[model samples]
Target: MIIVIDGLNKHLFGDVLDEVFKLRARVFEGRLGWEVNVVNGRERDQFDDLDPAHVVSIDDEGEVVSCMRLLQTTGPHMLADVFSSILDGEPPLRSTQIWEATRFCVDTSRLGQGRAKNSISYVTSEVMIGSFEYAQKAGVLDAVAVIDPVMNRVLKRSGNAPCDYLGTAKPMGKVTAMAALMDCSDERIASIREFAGIQHDVFLSEADALRLMAQRQEAKSPMPKPSVANQDHKPLSTLERYFVEQMRDARTESEVQDVLRLIESLSDTFTPEQKDALLNTPRAFAQEA
Candidate 1:
């Protein structure tokens, strides 16, 4: 199941939490230099101890895969303290009803090996949708991402608000995009979940569900004039196989929906219920999402 844990409570700050930090350092500092907080192999900063963050997604055996930090609009955030230079003296962030989304990262190593019922991308989408729910419940209005312009466009095209260029979009570094939550409506939240197609706790709209179905159909349809050699023998990747494997073990409709989401991300196709019945069978790894 997609778990949502708020705050660095006592439980989260335990040994598993240490593992999460080490993993973060391994990926962000050791590999990407995306962070400078590592001092002798520990990954942490002031933000680590503060800010009510959300940890979402788990591995095949149930481990954290993806997470995001959110700060209430009432306080100072990275936008004000760290990224102030990027923002031209003043950002729209000061406006009421906006919480900053930061430290958004994924444990790439543990994802897509049938680790969770959903893939990494699927999990992240779920987190975003979950973030919206969190914001709605908390009465927050906007969710900001320190992301690239390209990612900003993707979010906008997928129905997010117009992004403010808080930072430059670099090939190997950070950028910023703030996504506003336009609708706190129950209908809107539900639509987000259904459209994303991931097994999330939030409610979803049927229209969003239908749109996802259409998008999947479009993704699966054959394109014109593709290379013949590339077309004929294109087998499913290891990740694709893993997704199908997860689908086989799904026990509930929500679980099935989660697996279908992973399939949609990979194959870009949504099969009918009749077809799905053929897909859902017992599998070797029966772990939760």
Candidate 2:
């Protein structure tokens, strides 16, 4: 199923966004050899900070299988700010009715090959259908996408090919990139749906999506047993308890250091041993427990 998230409701879908960015890092940076900013294994760019809408496809396991980023062309966008060379010095298209779609990718490595809805091919078309449907509802008239020749062919094969071309293709890292435009209309959406053999609504309820996400996370790694220290010792200080909880949830080295830094900010209150115990004991016991 697909989940459409915008800047306004992003706080309610943190886990979904995490998986989408990680998938982008895997596909665009790790696999495609693209030069992009990847922090903590997540591919993100300046446009992400601009609060663009995201169309994400989730599997039954609640994993994000495919995602596409959407941004309004009235402001700074890929074609206007980054890939302007493709326009050959002509003014970049700027209008509220037109939007820019970039960072379009699918997690093919995990989904593998098939014609099923969960398969890469089906999910790709599904994302396309979701994007067009979403834009049309928001009063967007057309969409301009920065894509490579490979993606252009994929769109053609999926029966959702671009309606027009902008500028000549230019070298972008290992692959050449060009701009393609497509109208946002029910006819285009219907064509993609017919091609993909999907006739039902492609969205999941927010509550159901969160439940599936929780299930996926639990299946990957079960939660550790609670710390016995809380039961044996007296109640902890607010700072110390917060520190220990952060340690329990820390998933990366950077996150661990962030917790340590927070503890250090309260150095006047916590003794060195107290700080050490908060950091070491919880994680060590979590593994053994």
Candidate 3:
């Protein structure tokens, strides 16, 4: 189940926000005992307010399935701040090319659920694609992710690898013990986007990529400059952020759907009756992520 809740600057505070928190508490604290505290039914942390986070995927029935927290190099980040040693002091970020990736997890119950369809790994691929597309949208030239040893293979299969600037990988003496930086290439990034099966292009469309360098140069000028003002820059709000975090703790599709209804309803940007329609609708099933 992957549901991306975008365009929410107008409804940041209200009961809708409260529902997000409730969803977090129900999933993270109630379903999974992963957090140290659950005050007032919201799972929060020091990093939540700082990073530019987004809730990309939710389980079927609208519960969060997998979420990621992305921090740009222009600001303080885990790699540059707490894990500076991991980069060997060169600073992994060189440009608007972002160094991101952290706090990635999927619903526990969904694990091993899709092993049969080859989509068993599809959810993880969606996260990878989302991250890549997000980086491209931000004008990022490079992306770096610190992943557990087992998942490192996943990234590797996706054509990402450790960078020299990323220092050394740590070993925990098990298949999942090591953590390494996964560096993606432009082509690989495109592949990631294509794999996700989304409609949007990342940096360049397939047709654009097929164009010769000279043709690309010719196509560059005389076009209306794209305006970024209409674009969204802020991270998810306190409420929306919590809904994403809850997915890491969701164990069932019903629970996930329960959260989704609240999200759609609370997105009060819709008409009252539209909200009613969203609430009154039956739950939809998502292929196991």
List per-prediction Cα lDDT, in the order shown.
0.52, 0.81, 0.47
Candidate 1 local lDDT, 1-289, one digit each (tens):
3344455232322434555567667767875567468866767777666646555444444456776677755567666676556555555466556777766667777666432345665666666677777677777665665665555654554444433445443243443333323444455556545555655364323233333333343355442221222223334333333343345455677776665554444343333432243245323222221
Best model per lDDT: 2
Q: Tens-digit lDDT track for model 2 on 188-289?
A: 889999998989888886545645665665566544344654444444544454445456677887777766665565566667666666655656533332
Candidate 1, residue 231: Cα displacement in angstroms equals 67
TM-score of 3: 0.52
Candidate 1 lands at a TM-score of 0.56
TM-score of each: 0.56, 0.76, 0.52
Ranking by lDDT: 2, 1, 3
Report the C-alpha lDDT of model 3 over 133-239, residue by residue, as the tens digit: 65666677666665656566666665444553256665423322233544556676566545545444222221222122213223442422212221233332333
Among the numbered candidates, top TM-score falls to 2
Candidate 3 stretches greater than 4 Å from native:
1-43, 89-94, 115-120, 158-165, 171-186, 193-289
Which stretches of model 2 miss by more than 4 angstroms?
221-289
Q: Ranking by TM-score, best first?
A: 2, 1, 3
**What 10-residue stretch in candidate 3 is worst by lDDT?**
280-289
- Screening candidate 2 with a backbone cut-off below 3 angstroms (N, C-alpha, C), the clashing residue pairs are none
TM-score of candidate 2 against the unseen true structure: 0.76
The Cα error of candidate 3 at residue 62, in Å, is: 0.8
